[model samples]
Target: MGLVLAAGAGRRLRPYTDTLPKALVPIDATTTVLDLTLANYAEVGITDVAIVVGYAADAIAGRVNDFQDRYGVTLELVPNDKALTWNNAYSLWCARDLLSQGVMLANGDTVHPASVQRTLLDARGEDRQIILALDTEKSLAEEEMKVIWTSENGVRTITKLMDPAEATGEYIGVTLIEPDAAAALTEALKLTWQRDPNLYYEDGYQLLADQGLRIDVAPIGKVDWVEIDNHDDLARAREIVCPS
Candidate 1:
């Protein structure tokens, strides 16, 4: 199953998000971020997808049929009522019931090619509990969710608090969680939200790592992708989405 966390109000994007969720904002004239996400999953033959919705949920809820018809996939809408007050940890936790099933977690506001999903899915490792899609070639920034890890075997020390200079890669807001890691990840996410409702889902990954869960990374070498957070990012996404 594929899970999309689309609950954030994206206040930084202001006027653009005034009526629509960040996921609904178009990267190009025809394609929105969520459109591309569903397409990515469909390309990988994943049909059943769950989307956590909040912050003008109607915008997305209203278009559910259209999205399903357009993508040839089934979308289960998971509502997060506290989206305006709490962070994405809560939004993720809202879908706890679906944790047992293997899930490909993606942030609804990120835009990337289907190969990002294909690469992570194609990597074979029976022992890896969770796999994160990373962009090792991108320039690190404070805004990016940076990771500092020993690449000896797989990625380690997956967190965003590290200084950009010390980071090994930038997590591109995508993760593949196998069944073995589902329960632990769900517990960690619960603890993270209970401790602080403002924490991000990335904090849950850190907690899992502290408990010795191996959250590995699949570096997307030189891939064109962007997370639309603000107007500047939207501009960059437009360029990446429709390059001349």
Candidate 2:
């Protein structure tokens, strides 16, 4: 199954995000961030998709049929009532029921190619429970969700607060959550949101790592992607997806 967390209110990308969720924001004349996402899932043979929606949920709700028809995938809408008040930790946790199926999880705000999803799917194995798509080749910055990982321990730390110099790479908002890791991840996410509603889902990953979970990393070599948090990011996404 493929799961997408689309609940956050992107306050930074106003006017465009004013009436639409970040996922629904148009990246091109005929494609949206969500559209590209579903298309990617379909490309990877994941026909059952669950999207957690909030903050203009109706907009996404209205597009379910269209998305399903266009991508040849089944759409399941998961509602997050706390979307307005809480962060993505809670939003992701809302889809815990679907995680047991071994989910390919992606952040709805991220715009990337199907190859990123294909990379994680290809790297899946019995030993790998939670695999994050890491961009080891990208230039790190303070804004990027940085990860400090070792070949032995996998991911030691993942947070945006860390210094760019210490990070191995940036987590590019795509992950493979195996069935074995679902229970622990659900618990970790619950604890993360309960401790602080403002925490990101990456905090949950940190909690899992702290608890000795073997979180693996798959390097998405030289991929063009962007998480649309603001106008600049949206512009970059446009350039990546619809370069002219």
User: Candidate 2 at residue 72, lDDT?
Assistant: 100
Residue-level lDDT of model 1, residues 1-244, one tens digit each, is 9999998888898888999899998777788899999999999998999999999999999999999999999999999999999999889999988878989999998989989998889774868788899898988877889887675545556666778888889999998888888788889999999999999999998888778777788887888898998999999889988888
Name the best candidate (by lDDT): 2
Q: Give the top-scoring candidate (TM-score).
A: 2
- Candidate lDDT scores, in order, read 0.88, 0.93
Model 1 scores a C-alpha lDDT of 0.88
* Candidate 1 residue pairs in backbone clash: none
| Worst-scoring 10-residue span by lDDT in model 2 | 8-17
Model 2: per-residue Cα lDDT at residue 66: 91
**TM-score of candidate 2 against the unseen true structure:** 0.98
Off by over 4 Å in 2: none
